[model samples]
Target: MIELSEVMLEMKDIIKDFPGVRALDHVNLKAYKGEVLALVGENGAGKSTLMKVLSGVHPASTHEGEIYIKGERKKFANTKEAESAGVAIIHQELNLIPGMSVAENIFLDRQYTNGPSINWGKLYNETEKVLARLNIYDIEPTDLIKDLTVGKQQMIEIAKALSLNAEILVLDEPTSALTDSEVDELFRVINELKEQGVCMVFISHKMEEIEQIADRVAVLRDGKSIGDITKIEDITLDGIITRMVGDEVDEMFPKEKFERGEKTLEVRDLEVDHPLREGEKKVKGVSFEAYKGEILGIAGLMGSGRTELVSGIFGAYPDDTHGEVYIRGDKVEINSPEEAVEHGIGLIPEDRKEIGLLLTRNVVDNVSAASLSKFSTMGVMNEQEERKNTREYVDQLSIKTPSIDANVATLSGGNQQKVVIGKWLTTDPDILILDEPTRGIDVGAKVEIHRLMNKLVEQGVTVIMISSELPEVLGMSDRVLVMCEGEAVATLDRAEATKEKVMEYASGNF
Candidate 1:
């Protein structure tokens, strides 16, 4: 069937290089006009690089490749040129201004003008048309971008992309931040687009999604195409993963048990007030306990206040939070992150780039950031000691980098997360709260992070994790705490937490 359709997009020998690294090596791709081509690969395997070349983010002269649209070759100078060529990309990280209205953000550069002055009414009306095209009625065009939930912002990103009327659309980790209901809506829109003869290239690490939504899959490894484009029905999940990692993959979770120790941290009647809305709370009266040798997974849908609860306990918003925390039966005063670190608490935030890493710096600097005192004397710095300490973690955590001095921005998603973990590990905390620790990384990297959690637990660290992925919570958590809205609806033991049961509690049906 695909063979009968026209080739909407094609790439031949795409070679993308950055400094000394060759991100893409003679990679080739082909997609039919109405079909979805799934691009699956491990982090650092050149998926993003190849997409950049195609989307004109890298530009025509930056890479060695021939990109053809509808059997006609194109040379794009910038993103606008690519858009003119009917190419648009929705990046994993949303490109939206928090202060602007949705209408302004959607048609930012190309606003509808009435002679010299801008016509605000026309802008809002055009934005409404775009939202209506996506069947997104909940969001108003006048709404500020920051007021929306992440899921809604993500939907707005899709609406903005679709408004371009792209003939060849690239969705990079589009569903990573989306909820299940939003995902279903997105799939429905995608199917509608397929019927309209719009070609799509989907890049995701979630295999189940690829199997569900993709017509064909193309695997990449070490900056090269592993095999030819194959129909999604012709391959198993295991087969695709094998092509990705270049070997037979083992147990996905790699969960190991350890003896439960004393209660290391306890939260009683914790609440975090909304920063923007008066009398509204992001986290309600939530209570939980974490022991010395177990992974406590918090499961909930997006906007369920899971992150707020952990951040409140970590003293991230101590001024606006009301909570009672006990560390090993000792009531301590923790009104700031410094005090939390002094009380032996470390939190890995859900958004690593925004809150975790110093992207402009190197691995050594990021690893030594939280524990600078250890490598400093009398307000002076010790670069050697910092590098030595970072090297130890690089080896211990198996972090992949060109060197200790490699820029944090240059590393892959998995390695960036490892760097964040290594940063917290230097603090030597008794309690570690990881919010979406393995969010966007591949299956291989996820297993490594899970094993690292087990290692931390065995070493007498109390681990608290929040994951949107239900399978990860069920597979790796010793106990699952289900949250609905801002309340803890249920806390089930490992044996009691099934996918359906957890969803029931999370959906507020139980």
Candidate 2:
């Protein structure tokens, strides 16, 4: 463990407020040199708000706070001022031009010049140095950002921050989209930066990542710091959870068992072609079954075809999707999402902002989007019916919204996700498939969603879930289906599925 001797950054008595909510209330934080300080909280617990206060997204003039860099009080009016003060923040949604070259993106807005013209050689050479600081070499500076993997693009984001001579780095959910090996590489870079005495703040919802990389942990709840920053070695995971939510979490999973029942949905030799690459398949010859009164989990690594398999069955990916989907043991033809819905199959897609939500509309509109026909007759709409129905699901799901008429985008990540689930439940689907339903959500929200899943199963609605978190899959699944590189490799009952056994199959180890 590194000694926390030198305090590199500190925020004191920070109080930020909006028109109707107090985002941060007298919160304090400290980060030492050469160490990773983890800032964790439930969604809307002021983690992002606090970071914005520090990064000057909310100008110092707007918030009541005093920030100090190495005992020198500093106030930044803008992000550029924060950067000038040796501060940099990398948001989860990367801020890079995908069509440009790595060198171009890193040095964009201000290019290295020779006389009156841009010096190509000097700019590329400077980018190489920044990449080397992270010990990254295989990725050339001249490579197009679009050609790189998600993980590599994430590294480039860090490289851009370092290029600005940023001394205090803040990474927000940096590993949310990365593969396991990519996460390892990111940790390696972080360690290297720590050795160079660069202070770092890591914000994440993942407990395992915090345990692996953080030196100290601080919890936030309801816009207040729960307690003092405690050393990672001093606090148990249970203790952290308690501090985060202000209570003991008895069982995060809360999986309730159900007796084996009739089959509700089945897929035979499902195949889906790649959207762009010809003759390539995202999912190849995958088959699965979901039974009433049970949760069937699809577990796999990134690119293991779990999402594609469900999407193909749901008819969301219609082109070249050759699969025989059976509802209640009867074969059916599904050519589109509407057909799938008509067949009593509901899908909660993975991408929330892009596919699952209508951000510009209110919660009532989104909840009634798929089942508007139920609330209409003769091409006329029944908006009162829509509002009444929305209110019921909002209450049932415990979705924290100002009102049913409130814009869906105004809610927290967890609440927004609940709205999506509410939309599908209105249809009263016989079978439901959740693709990464708990992803990017807080532990509290995750627990709520899992409990809802159990409730659905008890109600006899078949639940099929796809999750990348192994612990979640192990905790909640009645049976686990392992996939590897477009193939369904193994199916194991909960009694026989261990982490080791599942990983072995997922990794194609037979």
Highest lDDT, which number? 2
Model 1 stretches with alpha carbons more than 4 Å out:
1-4, 97-105, 111-114, 117-132, 136-149
Taking every candidate in turn, the Cα RMSD to the unseen true structure, in Å, is 2.4, 1.0
Candidate 2 residue 408 Cα shift, in angstroms, is 1.4
Error of 2 at 72 (Å): 0.9
TM-score for all predictions?
0.93, 0.98
For model 1, residues 375-406, the per-residue Cα lDDT tens digits are 89999999888999899999998899999998
Q: Residue 444 error for model 1, in Å?
A: 1.8
The number of residue pairs in model 1 that clash at the backbone is 0
Summarize candidate 2's per-residue lDDT along 261-296 as a digit string, tens digits. Answer: 999888899999998999999999988888998999
